[model samples]
Target: MSLQQQFEQAVTDSKALPERPDNMTLLKIYALYKQGASGDVTGERPGMMDFVARAKFDAWAELKGTAQETAMQSYIDLINSLKG
Candidate 1:
């Protein structure tokens, strides 16, 4: 399958994982999904008070320079691992 197709399937699969991933893994998932779909972090980072939002933003920012295709592959890999 094409990378985009695999990535889309992974996105659907992510929602149905047998078990929920831990906080950090969830954050990584969010970051990779964002980077893959949207490319780079945008807008202001969430304020310190918004812990969850801040964490997610930081996670995405960490992948600022990552190419979308790379991020998509990483996301697909992560989701597959979680599925196992």
Candidate 2:
């Protein structure tokens, strides 16, 4: 299979991670997932009261310059590192 297919499979399998990762790692996973799936952040930022949404949005925004393929590969690498 191709690298992107492997990466996509890894992303699907990531849902089975034995334990939840730390905040930073979770943010990274979320950001990379969004980047890989959606390309870039869109729409307005969430309100302050919506902290979780805001954080996710910010995380994705940070990865604005990352290429989709790069983000997918990074996401797979991160899941492997943490799962091991």
Candidate 3:
């Protein structure tokens, strides 16, 4: 079992939880999306996401405070989900 395999298994297990993402979890997804949308993650390159997605991402980021690891894990789980 490699590190990547372990991570994938974790996300798969996490997604089956009763509460996939609480309020805080949603916020982290928004934050990551915002950073990606705003080009902050990509150095503000013009070829990033469109304006609408960026706006949505920002809105999502504003929904929670910083101390939300559970939510953050949900977001990570989501990203991992996309791998398969």
Top candidate when judged by lDDT against the true structure: 1
lDDT score of residue 10 within candidate 2? 83
lDDT of 2 at 13: 78
Worst 10 residues of 3 by lDDT: 36-45
lDDT by candidate, in order shown: 0.99, 0.89, 0.49
Q: Which scores better on lDDT, 2 or 3?
A: 2
**Per-candidate TM-score against the hidden true structure:** 0.98, 0.92, 0.33
Clashing pairs in 2: none
Q: What is the TM-score of candidate 3? A: 0.33
The local distance difference test score of model 2 is 0.89
* Full ranking by TM-score: 1, 2, 3
Residues 1-84, model 3: lDDT tens digits: 644455456555555655556554544555644433232332332325576556545555453353334444455566565445
Give a tens-digit lDDT track for model 2, residues 2-55.
778878888877898889899988998999999988899999999999999999
Candidate 1 lDDT, 1-84, residue by residue in tens: 999999999999999999999999999999999999999999998888999999999999999999999999999999999999
| Model 3 misplaced stretches (Cα beyond 4 Å) | 29-40, 43-84
Model 2, backbone clash pairs (residues 3+ apart or across chains), number: 0
Which whole-number lDDT from 0 to 100 does residue 16 have in model 2?
86
TM-score of 1: 0.98
